[model samples]
Target: MFESLKKKFSRTSEKLEEELIEEAEAEDNLQEESGSRFSFFSFGRKTDEKKEEEVVEEEENLLPEAEEIEEVPEAEEVEEIPEVEDEEIEEEPKEEKKSRFWHRNKDKDEPAEEAEDEEIEEEPKEEKKSRFWSRNKDKDEDEEDVSADGEAKGGIFSFVREKTIQEKHVEDILFELEMELLQGDVAMEVATEVVENVKENLVGKKIKRSNDITEYTYYALKDAVEEIISIPGKSMTEMIEEKKAQGEPLVVMFVGINGTGKTTTIGKLANYYLKKGYTPVIAASDTFRAGAIEQVTYHADNVGVKIIKHQKGSDPAAVAYDAVEHARAQGKELVLIDTAGRMQTNTNLMDEMKKIKRVSNPDLVIFVGDAITGNDATEQARKFNDAIDIDGVILTKADADSKGGASLSIGYVIQKPIMFLGVGQGYDDIMEYDPEWMLNQLFSEDEEIVENEA
Candidate 1:
């Protein structure tokens, strides 16, 4: 199925595994560093204590000099007593001001110097012990919390082996996945959505301690792929049969650029309906291109269905209108209209396609694209859908496409279901699209390795 896509995704998975391993090792290193930081912090506290002791000694030495300065003179003591009493009264307000300053700025200038000195000498031991214990305690709590994220608080050798996918790690993996998708020719919008979906599934998710990181990654990626390809209630065959059951012929119009196997897919579709017992009529409305009528005619003959056509360069809208009327008149169950192949950038051709769509009002407007076209096929489908409002897609040459970008992204980009895939040149090679089947193919490692070896 998606062998090429499988390889691409496998490479991405390998990269993810490598990154996870690196992150686990880094976590182990971080834990070790935390222990070393604890030791350093303890040694630093002792050094700070020693410095505090030296500062205390310096303060004590300065005390005697300070007292000498206070010995103003005993002779003047009596005369200064009355002045001292006045000074004391006046100095009370100054002391009050110094007290306020000390509180405001924790100053040690005057009024609170003794108190500040006493506090300084006594507080460091308690402060250091408290700080040291609290820091290590918080570190322990953080390690415990880190364990909750995916890795348990393991011993030095065990942490690296017990890595888990964290939110941060998921972001890194998504970035890498996006790059890989782009490289694999997945469209930017599709790639972005895929990664976003993966992120939503992975972020904040706590894996069981016994679970491997790769298991979570695999689920996230599988969910993402399934999401990208899924379009609920948009099955083309069901819609076609619904219209048929409503007593109307199911008219399906195919549109895409040249060489996308539009005609071949039309033949395959007719064969598909024929086997289901639905009478089909092929409409050769692609009159603009040389030999387009002959091509559809050959397919009609090969599929054993009647074909309607006009000469070269006939109005395609008229052809579609006539074909639908023919199918209705003949009581046919299906009408597969093959339109001319033209580049999506060609405005005249796009307008022509839109006119055909308006005229026929097909039950399903299918955009046929080459799966081998890679990213360009997605853009082609988008433009075609914009012009004609395509109901679904039928990818051709899928087996030849090693990258499988178009198959993976066309539906996501255009918001349409991929109805079928043309696996090979044989008319019977086509098959219905199944998202689950595709995902299974993508995630299959054995198949991927075998295909890669080939």
Candidate 2:
């Protein structure tokens, strides 16, 4: 039934999710750009430092070779070569004599040479093993350092990290939703409250994934609506039972503006109670309006319930009192007082309605409103509640109301529960108001299934 309102809520959630995701993506892109720039500059600086170190090492190696060349003797020392030659000539004969002895022991020296070669190979093998072990240890240590650093710095996967919802992210979206609600015939106060509640629920929350944005938004909107509709009060059936236990009828007074289906609502209520096995007496107290008494009487007869009615121009308060007396005498469980439909500005009619309340001392005062009237119904309910404290609300023609502004705003405006919804023209068309049902209608994807289940 609430097609327009449902669409508004759905759009708001989607828009908010989109806005937040966009902002998160923008921030991540900025971070990536800044990170890339920093890495590029650092790499260039490290390359320059390595080149300078290599140049210094080349100059040091050339200095040592030049010093060794300068230390060698020149050709001017030729005379000293004669003494060196005589020493070489005398050592040659000694070398020839020893050569014969060396030739004989060469076979024995071959074993030693083989052993020396084996030792040389073994030394390289040990060195290679140590180098491999050292390289592996260094690699493992580097890996550990990288992991520790990743944990502390959010790592390369920082772009996918959870985003915390900020005020700026939702401020514009919530404002838009508030304006849309107002345009949809929602009361300004109700719209403002919904926005504030949603903002409070969403801000500072962490969204771990893209899907979490939608989930969070849905719950935030649902919770705000739930709070607005959940007015604390006893239901009519409970009141009836309470009074019934005390051997008295539960008196209920109905008030509303003109042509909002007040009489028909009363008739429907009469039939509803009659079917419930409760002996209900209807009070035709709407004597100001022409045919009001007759209309109520017709319903009373049709529903097979007793009706206490007066002639035209009779005191409505007196009629209500008579009906309550009748219910008490007959041991009826309910007294439904139907009052004249009057505008909130009609002082005379308002005073008269108040008199009916004083005389009847109703256990509950209900404001019946037309759901199609939207904000007008909400305003009327507020005025009536200010005039007389209404215990609850009943919205008529709810099935025909596509906007559903009144159903959403009336109870919240008056701080009263919407006890029932008048869905159709038949006597059994009314159903008790359920907040969960309203939520399902607004948020469920399968509206037809939800309606059927409801």
Candidate 3:
């Protein structure tokens, strides 16, 4: 029956999923671009380092080798060298000058050769060690930089990283959903509360896969609705049993505006309890409205239950009081009081309804609302509750209510449980309200698809 509301919720989930997935994809693309830029710079720097290393290695290779000193002549060559020197002695000044030059050259060559040998031994070793250390240090630094970059960009396995839902990702989508809910006849506060609850549940949640988005969205919506419909209180059946155990009838008064099937719902309840082995008496307490007494009497007669009713223009409160006394005297297990339908703004009728409540002192006051009225039903329930604290609700014409706004919001807005739903026109058409059933109706995949097709 809640086709419109169901579609709204389903569309909201889908929209949120699409928005989040799009955001995630965009982020992945941005990170990929960043990683590509980083890789490009890294490649360029490596190429420059390779070129510099090549130049250094080439320079090292072209360095001249240490010069070898000439070995001294053998003993025979040494004697010939002495004879040559004696011949050169004829030019004594020239000989002395040449000998001194040779001695000076020999003395300088020895230290230069030793220094050259030390340089050859230590310089290449030191240079190679320095180059090796510098290369290793640079390699380590590069590795660290790449590691940091990878982490910052979500690494090579970026797809495995979970996406955390953010407020920004869902804000606009939720706002739209709220507007749709309001348009669907959901009460303003109820719509706002649902949106806030969903946001609280979704924001900061982590999703590991694409399917997770759908799953999380579904549950978030489901939970919010569940909380909205789950009013903490005893069911009507429980109250009946409790009162029955105490050997007293359960007094339940039904109140609502006109044309909400209030009297029909009362007849339904009477038949319902009658079948359950409880004798229920109907009280025609709506003596103000024309034909109200006859209408209630018809239902009571049709259901074969005793009705304590008064003539039109009589006191509704006195009628209710007499009905309660009749139930007590007859030892009936249930009392269903039907009050005249009155607009909440009508002070005289509202006060008269309150007088009935005061005189009857019903164990449970039920608000009968037309599910088709949507937000109007909710507002009526609120005003009725303010006048005389209603204990529960009965949503009539629920089977025809496709929008389902009143059914979803009435209980939550008034802080009362919806005790029953009138699904059809038969005397047995009413069924006890079930929160789980409503949830399933909204979230079941097959049902959703079927409704969409219709």
Candidates sorted by TM-score, best first: 3, 2, 1
**lDDT scores of the candidates, listed in order:** 0.72, 0.77, 0.79
RMSD of each: 25.5, 30.5, 31.8
Q: Write the per-residue lDDT of candidate 2 for residues 235-299, one digit (tens) a residue.
A: 78888888888888999999999898888888889888888889988999888888888888898
Clashing pairs in 3: none
Pick by lDDT: 1 or 3, better one? 3
Q: Put down candidate 3 lDDT per residue, 1-454, tens digits, no spaces.
A: 8888878876776576567656766677212212211221122234446879999999887664422222344555766766677777678888789999999999887997888888789975554333321312344333433332221121211234677889997899899999989998999999999999999999999876444565577678878999999998898878889987998889999999999999999999999989988899988988888888999899999999999977788888898898888888888889999998999999989988888888999999999999999999999999999999999999999999999899899999999999999999999999999998887666654434422222
Residue 294 miss distance in model 3 (angstroms)? 1.4
Ranking by lDDT: 3, 2, 1
Candidate 3 global TM-score: 0.70
Candidate 2 stretches with Cα past 4 Å from truth are 27-159, 447-454
In model 2, the clashing pairs are none
The model with the greatest TM-score is 3
Task: Please report, as a residue range, the 10-residue window in candidate 2 with the lowest summed lDDT.
Answer: 33-42
